[model samples]
Target: MSLHFDHNRPIYIQLMEHFYRKICRNELKAGDKLPSVRETAVEAGVNPNTVSRTYMEMEREAVVVSKRGQGTFVTEDQSVIQQLKETTAEQQMDVFLTTMKQIGFSEKEILDLIQKRLSALENGGDSNA
Candidate 1:
């Protein structure tokens, strides 16, 4: 519940990413109710308005649904959840690839490095070795 905010970005966007991670990891499953805006604001140490904006943005993205009386809930559509997972993976992979390229790693080198790391992990060796 304690979220570290990135001062370079909008808090609401960060909050949305937090929830996206939770959902992708199944920590916040489909149809699960999200914390109330005030509760989330207090937990994240942000203004309630920020939390409200986060929820509204999520709603716009079809990530969650806001009912008239009930609180916001995670989307029940399995396709949405699957898409979220794939999208998150892709974004992370993009960052990884860009960083590796910036560090002068070739495509084949990156692939080999990833394979070696996986092999090491599978053999119960230190992956960072």
Candidate 2:
């Protein structure tokens, strides 16, 4: 997965979230080996220590498991994965609403924007066409 870090938060936290989302989305499945810390760090342009820390945190959360000589793999629990996805979606939606409110967008305006964006996306984003 390609990870982009911003100034708002630490890179390790973003890495953890990114990996969780990937697993929750089934992009990474049970027994699927993850990239090495060095590889991921190089790919994400971050320090290996950050990636290692993120993976360690994920392991502690039971989102991933590591084998002694093998690599880290995504967990196999369907319920846990589903719950994570649901929670992530809800959290993202809440954040979106909060940001909209902060930007002076009313509920109706936000709903309209969502509809428009969905429609545009469904129409291949060719609004003028």
Candidates in order have lDDT scores of 0.95, 0.86
Task: Put down candidate 1 lDDT per residue, 12-70, tens digits, no spaces.
Answer: 99999999999998999999999999999999999999999999999999999999899
| Top-TM-score candidate index | 1
lDDT: worst 10-residue window of model 1: 120-129
How do the predictions measure up, each by TM-score? 0.94, 0.77
Candidate 2 C-alpha lDDT tens digits along 35-71: 9989998898898999999989988888788888888
lDDT at position 20, candidate 1:
99
- Say which candidate scores most in lDDT: 1
Q: TM-score for model 2? A: 0.77
